[model samples]
Every structure is written in C-alpha cells, then in structure tokens.
Target: MQKPSIPKGTRDFGPAQVARRQHIFNVIRRTFESFGYAPLETPTLENLSVLTGKYGDEGDQLLFKVLNSGDFAKDVTAADLETGSKALLPKVAEKGLRYDLTVPFARYVAMNRGTLTFPFKRYQMQPVWRADRPQRGRYREFYQCDADVVGTDSLLCEAEIVLMMAQVLNGLGLDDFTIKINHRAILDDIHQAVGGVVGQEGSLYVAIDKLDKIGRDGVTQELLARGFSKSAIDRLFELLSVKGTYLEKIHALSEHIRLSIGTDYTGYTDLREVYDILQASGFKQFDRLEFDPTLARGLSYYTGCIFEVKINNVQMGSVSGGGRYDNLTGSFGLPGVSGVGFSFGVDRLYDCLEALDLFTSTAETPTRCLLTHFDAASGRAALPLLAELRAAGIPSELYPDASKLQKQFKYADAKGIPLVIIMGPEEAAAGVVKIKIMQTGVERVLPVGEVVAALTVE
Candidate 1:
C-alpha cells in the first residue's frame, strides 16, 4: 500500500490553522472595503500565453504549466521532442496555474476594458502556485491578498496604496514592520551613474534587489560575476552605502545622481513627496517608513515607485511587496492605463505573526459553543436551544449523536471550542443548562432563557 503524502511546498491546514489564516484574510478584506475597493476574483488557470513573459525570465521559469488533456504526447513532433521540453512546451501545454495575482488581473482588465469604469479599485484574495522549492516561510502554493487601483497615474494613487498597506498591517496587529520605498527610475539613474550596460539596466536592478538577502559582499560578488566593471561597481556601492535620516539619504542620492550622471533627476523629489504624504496621512504612527535606495523590487512590471514591507524583529522574507506599473495592461492590447498596487504574502505574514505569538485571542473559531447531551431525549430537547443561540448571532453547533459524555467533551476540546453546553436529565429537569468553559474549566448553570444572553455577553 502507498503511504499518504502531499506534494512538497503545499500544506494541509487544520482547523486552528485555517481559523488563523481566515482571520488574516478577513482583516485585509475589511480594510480593502473600507477604502472603497470592490472585490475581484480571477480563474486559477490562465492561458499559457497570457502568463509567460510578464514576470521576467526568472519568474517565467517558475510557472507551473498544465499538460493538454487528451493524448498530449501523440501530437509532439519528432523534431520538438529532440529539442526537449522547452521546444515542445507549446505542443503539449496551453494553460498554466497562475503564478501571481497581478498578471491575471492585467489580463482581466484588458478583457473587460470596455465594460468597467476607469480608475477601478479592486482587491483579490486567492491562492497562487509557483514551481519554487519549498523552504521556511516559502511555499509552492500560497495565498496573495492584493489590492490595486488602475487607469490613473496620480501619485495620490501611490499614497493611497501606502496608506492601505499601513491599515491592513495594523489591523493584523503587525505593528513592528517597516515600509521601504524606492523608485525604478531612481534605480535607472543609479545604473546610469555607473555607465551600466545600455540595455541591461533592468537586469542590474534585479541583481541589486538581492542585497538584503545576500548582503553587500555577496551583491558585489554577484555584480562582478554578472560582468560589471570596477568603476560601475564602485559607483553603485557608493550610492548604496550612503547612510542618514530619510531626508538625508534622499539628499545624498540627489547629489550622487547629479555628480555621477551629470543630469538632474526627479527621483529624490518623488521620494520626498511620498514621504511627506505618508506622514500627513498618519502612516508614521503605525510603522516605520523610509526611503531605501537599495530596495530594488525584482518584478519587471514596476515602472515607478516600489514598496517592500519587512517585519523588524523577525528574520524572514518580505511580508508584502509591489509597486506602480504604468503599462501592464497596455502589454495586453490596452494602452496607457497606469496603476499602483501592493500584495501581502499571506504565508510569510502568518509565519511572522506565529513566531511572535501574536495570533492568540485574534484567531476566531468557527463554532463558539458545542451543544451536547447525555441521551437521545436530552439531545432532542437541546435542538430548540441550539437554534435560539444561532438565531441570536452566536456560532453554536449541536453534536448530532448522543455519544458518551466524555466523548462529546473530547470532541469539543479537540476543536478548540471555547464553550460547551450540556443538556442532560438533571439540567433538563431543573429548567437550566450546564455551560463549561473549555479553557478555564469553569462551570455554571443558567436558566434556559438566560443562556443566550449569558453566552452573548461572554
């Protein structure tokens, strides 16, 4: 017999885990709605053509392609087979699991361009798959909570996204995180400062984005391995090593750009304005916000400012990340629609919260009270009371079987239910019910009519 197993990088969440994850999703959703963003949903699978080439070369390699349903191998040409999987991919597969929500969202906007309003504000919470190797805080299948605003280039859109991120993180009780902001144009300027290869600036930025993970020495070695000249490497490091307050770093970067590129750039000004806006919008009260020049978000779609969120005390990957994409939809036949958005890495954030022991009291159980009885007659008598509790907006469940008393209590305990209701002969005869608090082992006998009021109060 085969042993039961699940694929690596995937997980089966138990009751408690699901409850905590749902709490995270609910907090993010409520925050999205409060900001006037409507909900959106896209399919789990997208056309292979629609997904490829959007997430850059590295991302494209991580996509999980689906095989054609019927006799897929028969259509494979001898020449295609000789050339291997890369050449034969199109012949066998035409659809793939979505790698990220942002790309599918672009496809959705393009397909529905005629019907939707301009400057649409939307949020999506869905699972995305990647063919990535599983590790701590990383998974092959996970959820992304994304909120975006498209059809406008207003910097206020960017400001609103920053504000929304702050609200979502705060709602989740993740207060010790930092929002690191940077601009692709600023990276472009830095690239130019070192006279970087004319057409490879994006590639250079992608490498620089790994500095936080790999450290400065590692980044230097990587740039060297990527064929960066000594002068270019030196200039890039100079900009990266500049240290000061947020404003001071902005000033130093402005001076570095003027000296190295011999031209004026708006990146410094953009960073300053965003900082001021976030300050005026009350973001500072919640978490640290900084102008981090070294933050090079690896996505190829980002056209303007980018944001990466990091939990201060925990050692983990970014908990949230995204930026402005000026022409994502344009690549799919709609031209000139610009947008700004961010996505929370649901798994990583959950791990961070768990490490800090922050999920207690916030993760809500589905069934608040489990109603049990000693026998068939008592179980039948408890039905009306269970209905009353549910009608009164309490999440109450009645154990269907008149199982052994100990077995019923074990079920309630195993489910992490907070309260258990007992309707046995003694309690039924007294016109009262016994309530046990699972955590505290506290017991109380209350009149049948007052049970709902008492549970509701507690």
Candidate 2:
C-alpha cells in the first residue's frame, strides 16, 4: 500500500500546535477589532475571472487553479492541448483557489457595493493557496490575517495601519522590528528618472522588491537581464542608496525626484504626511518606522503608499506586509474606491515565536481537572461531581476506565491537566473526595458539595 502523506508546503497541526496558532490568531483578531475593523470572510475558491490579472504577471503565475468538476477536458480540442497550459488552462479550469484575501475582498465590495456603507472596514483571517516552490518561511498554503478599509484616501488610515502593526507585533512579544514604508508613485518617478521603459514599470517594481532577498548585485543583474540600461540601474541604486533618518531620507528623495522630473513629488509628500501623523499622534515606536525608497511591493494593485515589516535577529522573511491600492474595485466596475490594508503571516510568526522560545505555557488540553476512580462503581460515583464541576464552568473530565491511581495521575500529567479528583468507595462512604494538585502533589479532602466551590475558587 502507498504510504499516507500530506502534500508538500502544507502542514497538519496537532493539538498543542493548534493551541499555539490560536493564540497568535486571537491576538491579531482582537487587535484588528479594537481598531474598529469588522470581521469578514470570503470563499476559498474564486472564479478565474475574478482572480486573474489582479495580482500582476508574477502573482498570477503563482495562482492555484482548480479544474472543473467531471469531464473538465471534454470540451477541449487537440489544438488546445498542444498550445500549452496557459492556453488550455481556461478551457479546463473555470475557478481557482484564492491567491490572497485582498482581491476576493475587492470582489466582495463590488458585489455588495449597493447595500454596504462606504469606507467599509473589515478584517479577515483565512488560508490562501499558491503554486510556487515552497521553502523556509514560505508555504504554498498558509493563513493571512488582514484588515482593510475601502472607499477612502486618508493618510490617517495609513498611519493607523502602522500603529496596528506595531501593536500586534509588540503584543506578540516581538519589539525589535522595522515597518518599512514607500510609495508606488515614488517608484514610478525613480523609474522615469532612470529611463525605465514606459510599459515595463512592473519589471522595475518586481526587481527592486527583491532588494532585500537578492542584494544589490542580484537586483542589478535582474534589472539588466530584464533589459534595463546599465546607467538606469546605477541611477536607481543611487536614489535607493540614500541613507539617514526617515525624514532625512524623505527630503533627499523629494529633492532628487523634483530635480529629475521638474515637478512636485506628491508621493514623497504623502509619505512625509504619514510619518508626521504618526509622530504627532505620539507613536513611541518611531524607531521601528523607516522610509525605504526601493520598497516596491510587487503586487500591481498597490497605487499609493506601501508597507513591509521584518523582525530583527530572526532568520526569516517578512512576517507582515501590505499597502494602499487606489482603485482595486475599479476592475470590478466600482471605480474610484480606494483602500489601505496589511496582513500578518501567522505561520511565519508562529515559527519565529517557537524559534525564539517566546510562547508561554498554554494548556495543551482544555480539561483542567480529571476525575479518577479505582473501579466502575467509583467511576459512576464521580459522574455527579464531574457534572457539577462542568456546570460551574470548570473544565472537568472523568476517567472513563477504572484504572490505578498512578496510571490516572500519569495521564493527567501528560495532558498538562493541573488537578485530579479521586472518588473511591472509601471516600464515597465518607461523603468526601480527595483533590490533588498535580503540579504540587498536595491533596485536600473536601466534602462532595464543596468540590465545585473549591475548584472554582482555586
């Protein structure tokens, strides 16, 4: 028989792992809600039409398409098969697993535009699939915790996103991180100044976005391979190499863009305003905010400011990222609606937490107290006590099989259950029960009715 196995780039979380993951989710969810973002969810599978062309060429190539139900190839001709997967994909697959929550959210906004309020704010925590090669800190299937606000062009929204990012990361016990900020328009200006091809701006953005991963030489090689002029690549790096504080770098870029384009640099100004807003609001973590000239989030829809976050001293990729999209809804026939958002990489964050040994001791199992018995009669006698404990909102469980005291204690210890209740025949006759604190090994004899109150108080 073939060995059973899960797909590569995916994971099966056991109970303890699930509990730890849930802890991460809970923090993100609570933070998103506290910022006045309502919870929203979209379907796992979205129609190909809705998914295609939204995330640019590279992102589109990473999409995981789902084939049509039976006879997916029944309508395809021999010529279609020979044309390659690209030509045949549409013929066989009409839908695909969502690449990310943001696009599906845009579709949702468009479909419900008439009924919903403007500037709809929502948070979504869901799994998305991709077809890319998976590696460390990168998965084919993973969860993204996102919060977005559509239908507004407020820089305050951008500032709030920065604040929320800091809050969530700090809440999760990660304080040393940087929230890199940039502008797509500024990237465009750099492209134009560097004599980048008019219609090939995406190439520049995609190449520059990998600056952190591949280093300067690598990005330059990619830019040259993509047909960028050597002088152009040098000029692009000249602007990207500017170093200083956030405001200082912003000023330098403004002067460069203004001198090169002979026009006011709105992107730089907007970026400055975001920083100023955060400063004015007394954001204490200004040290964590940075103005990155080369941070072009490769996603095509981002038309305004962009953000990416990296944790310090950890060997991992970005744990969170997102940006402002001016008119993502325009593709869905709802034009002129703007939005800004960010997403936390839950799986990566979990890995970082585990590596750093930051996860606190959380319950591996929900059962707080296990009722032990020596025989079937003793077990039956413990039933009433179990019900009472549960009724009092204490997580209590009964040892189903009559077992030795040592065996029961071992089971409770293995599960991290803290308390064990013993109700043997002798205790039953005495109208009392013994409660053992598993961690302390201290036993207390209490009346049957006092068990619930004692557990509750403890």
Candidate 3:
C-alpha cells in the first residue's frame, strides 16, 4: 500500500498544538461573550446555489463543490459531457463546502427570521474550505472566529466591532498591530472622481483592492488592461496614495471629491464619525486604529465600513478582516437587514503568536501533573489520590498500565508534565507519595495528606 498522507494545505494538530490553539480560541470566545454576543453554528456544507454568486467571479471559482450522491451523472446528456464539466456542473453537483462563515450566517438568519429576535448578535467559530493554491500562512482548510450583528444600521455596531477587535487582540497579548478601516462608499467616490463608469465601480474596486498585493505599477497596469485611461489611473493612484492622520486622510478625500465629483460625499463624513467614536471610546488606549483608503478588503458584499487587521513587523497577511454588508440576507429572501462584523483567522493568528514567541509555557503544555504507580496494588492505592488531584481542578492523568518506573518517567518527561507523582509499594505502605520535578530532576517525599497541598500551590 502507498504510504498514508494528508491533503495539501491541511494539518494534523498534535496534543501540544491543540492546547495552544485552545488558548487562542478561549481568548476570542471570552471577548465575544463579554460583548454580549451569543454563539452560533452553521453546517460545513451548503447548497451550490447559495454560494455561487455571493463572492465575485474570482471567489466563485474557488468554491469546493460536493458531487451529487450516487449515480451523479445519470441525468447528464451526451452533449453536456462533451462540452465540458463546467457546463454540466449544475447537473452533477448541488452542494459545496462553505467558503466563508458570513454568507452561511446570513442564510441561517434568513431561514429563521420569524423565530429569531431582531438585532441578532452571534459569534461562530468553524472551519471553511477554499479551492486555492496554498502556501505559507494560507490554507485550504482553516477556522474563522466570526462575530456579527444583524438587523441594525447603527454605526455604533461598526464602532463596537472595532473596539471588539482591539479587545480580542489585547486579550491575546498582541499589542502591536494595525486595524485598517475604509468604506465602500468612499471607494465609489474615488472611482467616480477618476472617471469610472457608474455601474462598473464593483469591478474597479476589485482591481484597486489588489493595490497592496500588487504595487502601484501593477494596479495601474491592471486598470489599463481593463480600459481605464492613464489619466484616470493616475488620478486613482493619487487618491489612494493620499497620506496623513486618520482625519487628515478624510479631509484630503473630501477635497478631492469636491474638486472631481463636485459633490459632498457622505463616505468621508461616515469615516470621520467612526474614527471619532473610536477615539472617544478610548480604543486607542490599547491598539492602533487607522483610516486606510487603500484597504478595499476584496469582498464584493461589503457595502459600508470595512476592516483589515495586520500584525506589525511581520510578513504574514491580514490575520483578521470583515465589513458591513447592507443586503447580504436579501438574496436569501430576507431583505433590508444590515450587518457589520469581523473574523479572526485563527491559524494565521496562531502563527503570529508562535513567530513572536508569545505562547506561555503552561498554555502550550496543559497537563500539569501525572500520577503513576509501580505495581497493581500501588496503582489501586493511588487511584484515590488521582481522584483528589482531579477534584481539586489539577490536570492529572494516571498511567493506564502499571509500566516500568523508568518508562513512565520517560513518558512524563516527553509530554512535558512538570510534576510526576509516584506511589510505589514502600510509599503506599507508608501512606506517602514521591514527587519528581521533570525539569530539575528533583525529588521530594510527602505524606498522603500533604500531596494535595503541594500540588495545589500556585
């Protein structure tokens, strides 16, 4: 048989890795809960129809469709198969893995519209799949920790999301990061100023969104290929390259809008108001929140304020991103509900923490102590002690088989259990337990009654 292997862009997290990942999840979950957001979950699989057009053309191509059950091709015509699979996909596939949680969440809300309360706030932590080339910091399968609020149009929801982002990062011990904020309406204003056609701003922003990924020259070349004049391209770049403080950028964009579009733009006003809310709420007390006109966020669904978070001094991509979508639920037959939220890319954030050496020793290795015995009688006698340790909330496990003492010690050392409790025949007879510190190789004998006290010390 061929050797076993996992698919590319997938990972098998070991025990230690799982513990570290749990710590990250715990941080995000606690922050979400503290903000009064309730937990939610959606299935990994959704109908192909529900996912196809939500993301743009490029995003639609990355969906991993599930084949129809047995005899999938039974209905396909000879001409359909001859033409190519793309044309025949509808007949053969009806379901696909969800590419992101936001769309699925929208679908969930729409389906339960009458049963659920208005202004629903929910947080979902789940894996999503994408059929794309995988590389460093990019995965085909990964989890997204998302918290969104629907049924409200207040900008306070947007401001609260920014503050929530700051809270979660600070809780994770990540103080060095930037939260880039922008608005789709402002992008439209820039596009209009640069002579973009009324109905084509979506495609224009999609290309302009790649400015960070591909530099100015690359974006200009793309705009040119899409039939934009060099003059328009230059003006677009000038608007994007405008620099200053958060308010200064807003002012610059406002002046450019007045000169080019000859109209007052609400997007600039909205951006300034969001920034002011953050300042007044003291979000700056913990993290850096800035207005970045170049941050387009690439998603076509975002219709209001957008967010993208990146770690400072690291080469990794944005560890978190999301924005407002005014009509996402309309496609599912629930119209007029507005929602704003953000998602934490848990895997990327994990990598950031690991690269920065921020994971604490106890967080990485969760099991604090191990209890083992030398013989069958000793093992039976040690059971009560193990029970006591567990009841005291100490993470302790007993060696299943009364194995050799050296072998047991080796297992404890390999697993990074800091303390090992040994109850041999002599110790059992004397009603005492010997404790060994794996790191220092130091040993101490304690009476049975004193074992709990020694292990319980913080």
What would the TM-scores of all predictions be?
0.95, 0.98, 0.96
lDDT of 2 by residue, 212-294 (tens): 89999999999999999889988899989888999999888878877887556788889889988998988999889999997
Q: Write the per-residue lDDT of candidate 1 for residues 1-458, one digit (tens) a residue.
A: 99999999999997678889988999999988998889999999999999998888888999999999999888888899899988999989999999999999998999999999989989999999999999999999999999998998778877777788788888888888888899888888898888888887877887888988888788878888888987778888888887877888888888888886665566677777877786787666523777888998888999898999999999899999999998899889998999889999999989999999989763236898999987789988999999999999999899988789899889888777889998899899999998999899999989999999887887
Alpha-carbon RMSD of each model:
1.9, 1.2, 1.7
Clashes of each: 0, 0, 0
Model 1: worst 10 consecutive residues (lDDT sum): 281-290
Better of 1 and 2 by lDDT: 2
TM-score of decoy 3: 0.96
Backbone clashes in candidate 2 total 0
Best by TM-score: 2
- CA lDDT of every candidate: 0.87, 0.91, 0.88
Q: Candidate 3 deviates by what RMSD? A: 1.7
Candidate 2 clashing pairs? none
Tell me the spans in candidate 1 whose CA falls farther than 4 Å from its real position.
Answer: 361-365
- Clash pairs of candidate 1? none
